[model samples]
Target: MDDDEVILSTPEEISAMAEAVKENLLPTKSRRLYEKSYEKFMSWRSEYKTTSFSENVLLAYFNSLIGTLKPSSMWVEYSKLKSMLNIHHRTDISQYAKLIAFLKRKSEGYKAKKAHTFSPDDLQKFIDNAPDYTYLLSKVAVILGIMGACRRQELHMLKIDHILDADNTLVVNIMNTKNRIDRTFTITGKYYKLVKKYMNLRPNTCTSQNFFVRYISGKCVAQNIGINAFGQMGKTMAAYLNLPNPELYTGHCFRRTSATLLVDAGGNIMDLKRHGGWKSTAVAEGYVDNSIQNKKKVSNLLMNSIEKTQPHNATTTYIPETELVPVIPAPESHQKNITPTLLPSETEPTQTPLLSQIQQDSDIPINTAASRNGNITPTPLPSDTETAQTPSLSQIIQQNSDIRINTAASRNGQTITISHNTIHNLHLHFHK
Candidate 1:
C-alpha cells in the first residue's frame, strides 16, 4: 500500500474493505454506538422490504420518527446515523440542506431542559454537616470540582501524583482534560487539610494512580474512580443536602455553580472564562446573567432610576405622593379697588375679563412697582417662611395651563403684595 510501487495484478478491491473503513472513521469510544445506529437503519430497511438507500429513503425513515421522537433526540439520532453512513453508504448527511432545515423547523419553540446550579449556601451546608470520614472522597471531589471548576472527565483522569505539595499547599494539576489543555489550581487553608487527610489515608495496596478513590463505609478501598461516579458527585451531594429534584443537578452543576458564584461575587467574566476553561464569552456571561446577585443588582438599578426624586443639592425637594411644598410665603397685605394688572405692559387686555372688566370695561388703577418700559420682579421668601400643610393652587396651575389672574374691588385699599414662594415661574404686579 506504500509508495504506489505498482497498480499490478488487476487492482483487486475487497468488499470487506468497507467495514474496515467504517471502523476507522468512527471514534474509538463510540464505535459500538455508531455500529448500532447503522444496524437500526439496516433493520428498518429489512422490515419495510425496501433495499434501496437514498435521500428519499432517509427522508421517509426520519419522517416516521417525527411524532415519536423529540427534535433534540432526533438530532442525536441524526449525528449517529450521519457518522456511520459517511463511511459505508457514502452519504454526507451534513450536505443534506433540506434535511437540516426540516430538523431545524421541527425544533422551533423547543425549550431544552437546563441543569440546575446549586447555591453556595447549600454547598456550605453540605460541607459543614456531611461527616468527613464517611464522605472523604466525595468531600474532596465536590470541593475540587467547584473550586477548580473541573469537568467530570477531568476529575476522572486526575492522578494521585498530579497533586503536588508546595510549601504546605497542595497544587492540583489536571494532566488529562476534555480540551487537552493542562490546568493547575492550589488547595490551601482548610481545603488543603481535607485533601491532606485523604492523601494520608490512601491504602498502599492500591495499584491505580487516580487521585479520587472508590470509598465504602468511611475509608478509601481502591484507586481510579469511574467517570460515571465522578458525574454523579453533584447528584449525590444534592440528594444528601435535601435539595429538590437532585437528579436535575447534573455533573456540570459544579462547573456552573463555580461560574455563578464567582459572577455573583462580582468576579470578571473573562477571569471566570479562564478559571473554567470556557472559550466562549456567551457561555461565561450566561452564568453572570443567571446569578441571583447580578439579577438583584440590575433590579435595584432600574428601581432607583424610576423612583429618583430630585437633584443633589440640599434645597432640592421631591414630589410627595400627594402634591405638596416645603414653604409658602404669606401675602403682605389685603387690598380692595385695586385691579391688579398681572404684568406691567401699560395697557390691559380688553378681551380677557377681570373683576371690573367682567361686569363692564372700566379704567382700572394699578400699582407703581415698574413703568411701561421696565421689567417686573417678585420678592422671593427666605428659608424661615411658613410652608403649606396641604397642596396649593399653584400645583393645580402647574398641572394645568398657565392663566393670568386679576382681581378688583370698589373701596379704598393699600398695595397688594404678591408672594413668589411655593409657586414656580409665577409673577403678578399691581399699578397705583
Candidate 2:
C-alpha cells in the first residue's frame, strides 16, 4: 500500500474499528465507570447463573446494594450497567416499564445526603494550618478550585500556560471539565495572591507543564496530581482544621461552597451559570437553595425595604397598653334616665335653616329669656300663595305693621319671628 493511500480492511478489522470509535464517544470517566460496573455484574453472575440482562436481576442487584451503598451511588451503578448492557446487546434496558417504575420509586423513597460545604472561616483555618512547602500545593489547589468553581478533574488537568495575568486579575482557562466545555474565570482579591505565592514556590526541578504536581519529600515526583490525591488533600485539610465529619468535605465541596458564596453575595443566576459552566439555571438554583440563611436574609431585606407606612392623617388610633380600662355596668336608675338622642332625618336639612346664621355669628347673642321659661311658640309659616306674592324684606316690614314680630328661641338655639311675609325672603337669602 502507498503511504498516502488507505488500505481496505477485513471484516474483523472493520468491526474492531467500529467498536473503538463507539467506546471513544463516551467520556473517560463514564467509560471507566461502565467497565467497573460490567466487571461487578460479571462477578455477581458467577455465583448466580440465572442473573442476565433482565429487569428482575437488575432490580435484585440494586436491592442488594441498598444497605451497603448510598442511593446516589446505587443509581449511578444502575445507569452504568444499563448503558453497558445496551451497548453490548443492542437493546434499551431503560425502556422497560417495570425497571423505570422501580427506579422512580427508589429515587422518591431514598434521598442522598450531600456533603458539608466549606465556609470562608473554614477555608481560612485550612490555609493557616499548612505544615510544609509540599502542602502549599494542596492549598493552592483548593483556593483555585473554590475561586474558579472548578471540579477536581479540572483542577488536576490545569496546565501552566492556562494561567494568564491580566493587570490586577489572574485569568484561569479551565479545560477537560465535567461538561466537556472550556471556561475561563478571573481571580482577584486574596485568591490572586495565593496563586502567585504557589507559583513562586513551585518546584523548579519538576519538568511537568501541568500547573499542579505531586510533591514527595520536598521534591516534585509526578507530572500532574491525580484526582484521588487532590480529593484526599481536601479531606486532610478538613481533618487538620477539626471540621465536623471531615470525610464529608471532599474536593467537590469547593465547587459547592463557591456557588453558594456567589449566590449569597447576590450574584445573578445567568452570571453564575457562565462562571461555573453550568448547562442550566436549575443547577444554579439548587446551589442557592442550600443557602437557607442567605435566603432568609434576602426575604427580610425585601420585607423591610418594601414595607409601607401608615399615612400621617390616617383615622386609625393606637391605644397605649397602660391606658386600657375595663368597663363597668351602670345602675338600673341611671340606665333608665339615659335616653338615646335621635339623629336628624336625612330630608330635614338639604339646605341650612335661615336661623342657622344667628348661631354661627358670635356677634349675635342668643336671647335666653324665652328659652329659660321652656315656652317655644311655633311660628306660623306663610302659605305657598302668600309666599309667592311676598315682596322684599323692607317692603314686608313696611306693609305689615300689625304682625307680631315676637322673637322666640327654637329648640336648635336660634331666634324665630312670627311674620308670614318675611319668611320667603329669609329662606331665599339663607338657601342661596
Judged by lDDT, which candidate is best?
Answer: 1
Candidate 1 is scored at a TM of: 0.64
Query: Model 2: how large is the Cα RMSD against the reference?
Result: 16.2
Alpha-carbon lDDT, every model: 0.66, 0.64
Name the regions of candidate 1 deviating beyond 4 angstroms: 1-22, 49-54, 281-289, 304-315, 318-432
Clashing pairs for predicted structure model 1, backbone only: 327-387, 337-409, 366-431, 366-432, 367-430, 367-431, 367-432
Among all windows of 10 consecutive residues in model 2, the one with the lowest summed lDDT is 402-411
- Per-model TM-score, in order, reads 0.64, 0.61
List the lowest-lDDT window of 10 residues for candidate 1. 423-432
Encode model 1's per-residue lDDT on 49-107: one tens digit a residue: 99776777888888888888999989988999987787765678888777888889989
